[model samples]
Target: MCGMLGGLLLSAVLIEGKIYFSETFGEGWQQRWRLSTWKEGHAEKMGKWQTSAGKWYRDEVEDAGLQTAEIMKFYAISASFEPFSNEGKELIVQYQAKYEKDLACGGGYLKLGPSTEDLSKFGDSTKYNIMFGPDQCNAEKRTHLIFRYGGRNFLKKAELPYKQEGEGLSHLYTLHLKPDNTVRVLVDLDKIYEGSLKDDWEMLPPREIADPKDQKPSDWLDEEMMEDPADVKPPDWVESKMMVDPKAGKPEEWDDEEDGEWDAPKIENPNFKGPWLPRKIPNPDYKGTWKARIVPNPDFSDDPDLYKYSDIGYVGFDVWQVKGGTIFDNIIITDSLKEAEDMAQKWKALREVEDAAKKNEDEAQAKAFEKAKAARAARSKENKAGDTKNEKKDEL
Candidate 1:
């Protein structure tokens, strides 16, 4: 499956040439990137952003990517570049993200937008051309792929495939948008969704729709079955669900003033029959569901270049994290899927090594904890014995 998807992606974007922009955070990344200190609701409190080369996996740490402060409230940060257009070429956006603190509620996504005069003022209100990546809060875990169309942002109509179970591991997310108005989403280089933009998003009204002039007749019988006219309820059938118990009687010694008023006990009725429902028979006049005839939608106008973005000058992370420890690295915007895949392959190799080291560290830590617990138990037993001896001496 991986091979097949890789082949398909290669065929799709291999024709496109140069990379528009790329960021690997090699050195002096702080100078290139800008951090946002914006708080929720324009509140006084704000989150601070910091860069890190090490990622925390449980107690183990591996050298990699940028991380937010461990106690972040709400954070936003971005990096800007000169405007570039992907007018008639495939646009590929790929990045690696890891939530090392097992993100319970947060967004580990990035946004692509046109140039803003102030990168420091970037926040939720900033207009973005494309926003894609992982987001999880409460029980909802989704991969958001929102695109700005006309004047509003629109979310993809189809269910986005996202990683919901794992954490502390880096996953590569890649978005491929072609000039033909089609898009594909890949996680770890595996294609999760591939469909046309018009079919997946409400970017435009459908090309055809049910005719407004056509309507179902008032006497149309769409029911598949009807109550049997010949069937009748038996006279002996009882509908009551409960009845007074014949064997139950009030205690003779009961005082009306002190004790509650005597009453017969209620029990399940032995002769109870469920509410009578007439038997159903096939409806001879039944017609299947009525659907109006379709006609070409007058409002729809095709736009073959819907996927093209004229200017995408900045890429940033505008997210709200409950428990922050997400690392963002290796952001690349290119016109080549092959370049993205090559980068992904490098990250995948590094992830495997990191995962193995983390597993070993976790195992060693668990063993050490168990050994310390047993030693503590022994020491506690000796202390208790010494206290008992002192108490005996005092008693004597």
Candidate 2:
């Protein structure tokens, strides 16, 4: 009995230890990414890494622009496992991350596996994202949450301040996977924005394969993974059909002309004022008083004036940190999209007013120029007349 039990335990351990794929920043492996490069079209920079005590470490820095709340977040991320293994089992994963002290406008996270489909019921759902950044200020100075779901992708999501009293560091996020394929995320460090859906969470079922028995294929596996033998009897018409050739690349007689290729238009950041930071979502269901905290970055000696309008073309900065303060925890549950639109509309109106003022100034300048030209013409005419009269008098 003891021998049998030991053998069973060994089998279980072997199965558990089997890794489909993995790449830790171990001895020789080095993977680093800049926190700033997450901007839509920010160009990627060369990565830097060092070896210490037989271990390898890489650091990624992003030039996320010079504006405050322009969160520059990067992660040394990796993904492994046989995606097409046809196994219907879900995975539970965990990892550790560390952030530098006074690392204003930054945070890190470990992302798990992702599906390649639009999981959000709304046709516009993203697949993966991670959050990071400084945790200060209310509704303005914010940390970051980055995600890429559906086809559209965005970076540096602004975090709302929900903490009130003490200073805290180090965050742990856990994912709970249910047998029903539902996944939930829990943030351990700060409970500001909790229980938010990271993606559409694709939970739809497949429709291809029919039954597992009678030579029928499983729905989990793709068509190309199925195999058939020529000599053997062709099974039922449904299951006997030859599967797509997985080894095939592009068709041999492919014609580029038939399918014209066009480059996607690249988007660049507008040369606008500083504080071009992400939008913040405010909680509206608060019951008591709330305070805003000013998160300081000691490394930066430049006064907040650097981001003032006189310096960057606009008056007030887009995102600003609190000099010294803290916000007490208050439950304000509300939607963010509506709030962001309201804020944007206000900005739009202000811009319109500025534009109208500028137009009026231009018109006034033009009118003055016209008046000066008219006066000069009248003077010239009078001088010419006087000279004609004098000539006439001399002739007489």
Candidate 3:
């Protein structure tokens, strides 16, 4: 079994594919990556990226990747590569990421865009061909795979499912856009979704739309039900909820000249009916709710190259993290599925070590918590005894 698995790994590594841009965040990474100056003028509001393997990892130096170093700040950075166009080729983007702390609200996504002179000016508004990654805030968990067409970014209409991989542990994301306009997303080696681009996103104009000149007729009876014309109030029906008691007598101490006249107390009328509502019956003349006429959209056009990005020269992370500790590494923009899988194998080996470390840390935290709890209980007991001793002295 071991020999067979090794052969498979060898085959994956040997599969031919083109790698456009890749980064492992090795030494001198600061020279390759440029941080944005969008928030530089502000006082201490900008977040910076640094290399790390975090508190626990498989190999400190080997696992080191660019991590957001500051808390409660925004981070923007990008690395440029030789400009290339994936007009007729398969495109695959893969990355390894870890939200070491406060994954409560932030994105671990990256974008591919064209090269620019001022990397310092790169910010959230920077236009890009594709934006793919994991984003989370509060209860929403999304794997964003957006395609930009005609200056508008379109997200997949169907939600891509996502799950958390615990704190301090790394996760892998792989997005593949095929030459056939099909796409697939994988998280931690698990295939999450696979479908066509045109079916999943609104990149082209809709086939049909509501007619602008059409209107519902004024005489249309849209109501499905109406009050029954035959239904009427019965002559014996009582409207009063409560009534004066007819059998009660005035008090014996009552004085007619000095006191006001005595009145009987009220009691719920047994014959009373609750607020009356007319019985509903189906309207014979009812036409269902009116709708405008549908017509073909004038702007409707289809393109076969929705999956293509004309130019991809830069890979960047433009993100705002309230409490940042997200580490992004092993980024690859390639054209081979096998190449991406081989990288995934690398992450698998690293994750096994990280998971074991996370388990040990969690257990240690639990044990420390128990010890603190016992000490607090002992102190409370001593305080109660001291209060009792003082009470006895006061009694003397």
Candidate 4:
């Protein structure tokens, strides 16, 4: 009986440890993902998702995924799958995004939720278990990491680090949720944030709070310093900050109507001592700042499994962009961090090659543009000289 039980437990562990879903958006990706629509009566505008090398490419066209149409339009899309439970396991979500147009304002993020029935209705009101990615609008550019708690969505209390500007390069964002109720956020495979879920997220009210009935005593001397009674103002101190020059007088030949009325110019008084104040000295009765006593919060409750989500059935992007040319590809969701990291490494290698190709192409284009500009300038100069010579001949 013991041997049979061990075998069954091992099987369950293996099943939970494997990759739940992974998509590179290679050939026939349309079968796996669905594009959402915005409807007005009979008119429906489905979000444009077409394959591209994403502003940079190697010789291989297979290394592309569906990119945003990049126009004055709204977008909402999702790809659903079988419901996967993250309970008692590490949930890893990873993906790559490229802002080819150096997106000035847009959301390049993904949402994971349980519902898949009405992806077209996905909007700001849609609830999600997790929302992670870079978002920028005007001066505010940051990675958004929001989690739903007790039927309400709560954003991370700490500011998520993200780059507002882009260099037309692809970046990978990864989120690792460990079974121990801890989370780690990474950008480009580098860990940017790591902490317990309870500390970083306000999932619950604080365990303790300042006692309401307790207050600082009115007679408590919190000030560290006081004015020195011994210090006094000097006898020669000038009261006025500025004074009229006694040696100067009105011009003798001045006419009131023709010339402006002559007046002695007021200058800063050298003898002036700005305000009179005694020097500060250490206060004898000084007391430290009073802090209210803390007690257990009445409403505080503990939940060790706050990081666990029951079901995550779909991954989607619902974003608005001013000038969208963002490409999202190589999405992976698994229970193993090692699997996610390995996937990121594979994508990183491809990005290096594509980036190099883009650099070379840019240089070649710049040189060609400069050569054309020079030729145009030379022709213009020759025409001007010929016109000048014809003008001189006409004068002759």
Candidate 5:
């Protein structure tokens, strides 16, 4: 809508988007989510999933999410939903994750795949259609955005940096995949990467390959600048960079054959010029570079529906975590960009409340530390004064 408001023109866009699947984990999350029984016998290595708002939040109910409840374990969990394909429409996959503890290594990502009859069997071996999220282990950190094609997973070539330092704070990870084969990756609503799938991923064969029959000629002069035939090295230029010192004198103890001929220690020659050659000019016979002529790749075949997914009925999380306190919530798969943006408002509000609360807590801790330091200093000063008085009395 466009109108004149107080002599100033204003316009507003009210756009809406469709939601394919959404999970808030508010109530009955256990019924909706299924935990994998991987390593069920190994009690020490198996991790568990719990729901909570963490230690701090503006609204605990709204902030509640599924969190990796233990440290140093492998956690695999998933949920099943009605299967649907993204054929001609745009696709948006977005989620919210927060690390409540220092994340030494882990993944906070999502996987979309086929619907399963048995949810208990979902594990690492299960296949997925799309895998997107933040993965960090020690110093290695990146958001994994991978797509499956031809029964193989192809990771995006573009690396999206993952921040492991923002502990206890929520982050938004969004991937916008358009039917046009372009993708936009965003973190906290800020676009980090935007490019086409055909260029950012090796999902297809090369359009052309080097022809085996084409070869460089035997006399092909490929070098742009070669030693000039007309130009020659200066006659005075010496091949040796060093020579016998002219000022050095051999010892007077003369023994011609017994001690061998006395030779002066070699020193750098000041008059000697280094290796010289003719200055390079443009080559008249350069064929640029002798390259094998490119021919159409026999395996090359274009896929018009490269972005389409036939069936994406299930979404799950399958990863290994050395140290884990990652909470995941507010996952949504939709056909509308505006819907994801609107959902991000919840995370933004949560962040504002968290920042303010953390600031207050830090200030209170600092004040208490300063007061304790002052008391310790005062006690030391009094003890020193008492010691001096006692020493004077002893002297009297």
Candidate 6:
């Protein structure tokens, strides 16, 4: 009911400020399923109605709609533990989940591996399997289809058809095992991503091989002997490679007129100025940010009101100062322009999620009231029938 009111197909439930994708679909949308947490006494309560540690969850919210790419996440919960003492040992990770109902309009993928702070360390070198289809897949020449893979790059992995009947789902997913074998990924099927599979999975590459000598093991192993890569440290090159180059764009340029020597020139407009831009409004269920800003009005010669500098003219002041003001908003403050855009997208998504959650709560309350009213009416009818039967029996 919250989903219907909020217009969310697959509404994510935020419990204690944490978001979770509900893995339930079909006619009976009363219950939700998700991974269990590993709290004290959770193992025994996992299968129980209220104490399941890592088993699927049953949410009280009803179906609103299907979720789109606006929701991205990384989560993995497994009861089985594999001890890892091998370094650079190759392993495959796989899991199977059944779709209860056929989704006519939905898209997403699944990935498994180590996790980084912002999905920066994911890669194809790790074994992985993903199946993204429809718009999410972003295939060159296909529509409404699925793409499968075992690597970060789709081009380097396998692709498969993801179409299924009403209750059909895919199986046989595979991912590489890293030295720090702990796995993290966005296993939700109703989300999309723009980056490679590793980014989509939100997994970090292994920091260190469990066994340094096992870094390039002779063979790949199945999931049976897998271990967690929690105690590993990233190799030297990984840290060095991941470092951000401070002088990335300030490369020295050779001036032909200066005898082919390299010299770094200062930027003309180092302090960028721009106007405040507005963002676009997505659907109620949308969960991405949108932003735009008006370009900053520079005190350049172009503005007739401001003192202008001509191409060949110079100011004739002996000891005068020239200064003006510039206004900009939603511009690059610390990160890149693209990162700012991404932040806007995330804000938009958060708004959508909040709106959806509010709507879902309202609908659930209404449904509860309706059910209570119906139950009360049925009880009243039964009471009247019993009164009549008692009177007839007394007369006999």
RMSD of every candidate to native, in Å, equals 6.8, 31.1, 6.2, 8.4, 6.6, 35.2
Query: If ranked by lDDT, best first, what sequence of candidates would result?
Result: 3, 1, 5, 4, 2, 6
- For candidate 3, lDDT tens digit of each residue in 1-396? 213223322322324678888888998889899988877577387787888998877789989999998887888899899888888777888899898885678888898887777788788888888888888887888888898988889999987876545888888887777777888777776778888988889888888999999988988999999999899988888889999987777889998788887778988899999777779999998999889999999999988988877778899998878788899989888886666666777688888888898889889999999999999999999999999999999999
**Which 10 consecutive positions of candidate 6 have the poorest summed lDDT?**
312-321
Model 3, stretches more than 4 Å misplaced? 1-16, 210-220, 236-275, 290-295, 363-396
Q: What would the per-residue lDDT of candidate 1 be over residues 168-215, giving only the tens digit for each residue? A: 677788898998888988887777899988888989999999999999
List the candidate 2 regions with Cα displacement exceeding 4 Å.
Answer: 1-24, 31-87, 112-171, 184-396
Question: Model-by-model lDDT, in order?
Answer: 0.81, 0.29, 0.83, 0.78, 0.80, 0.27
Error of 1 at 260 (Å): 25
Query: Candidate 5 on 320-341: residue-level lDDT in tens?
Result: 7877778898898887656666
lDDT of 4 at 326: 83
State which candidate has the highest TM-score.
Answer: 3
Please, what are the lDDT tens digits per residue for candidate 4 over residues 30-111? 8877766544352334456677766565434656866887564567778888888888887889898888776667889999
Give the range where candidate 3 is weakest over 10 consecutive residues by summed lDDT.
1-10
Assess every candidate by TM-score: 0.77, 0.26, 0.79, 0.74, 0.74, 0.19
lDDT of 3 at 209: 100
- Candidate structures ordered by TM-score, highest first: 3, 1, 5, 4, 2, 6
Flag the better candidate by lDDT, 2 or 4.
4
Backbone clash count for every predicted candidate, in the order shown = 1, 17, 0, 0, 0, 50
**lDDT for residue 112 in candidate 5, whole number 0-100:** 88
Local accuracy of candidate 2 as per-residue lDDT tens digits, 176-245: 2222323333333223343323223211122233333334223333223222322343232232223444
Report how far residue 227 has shifted in candidate 3, in Å: 1.0
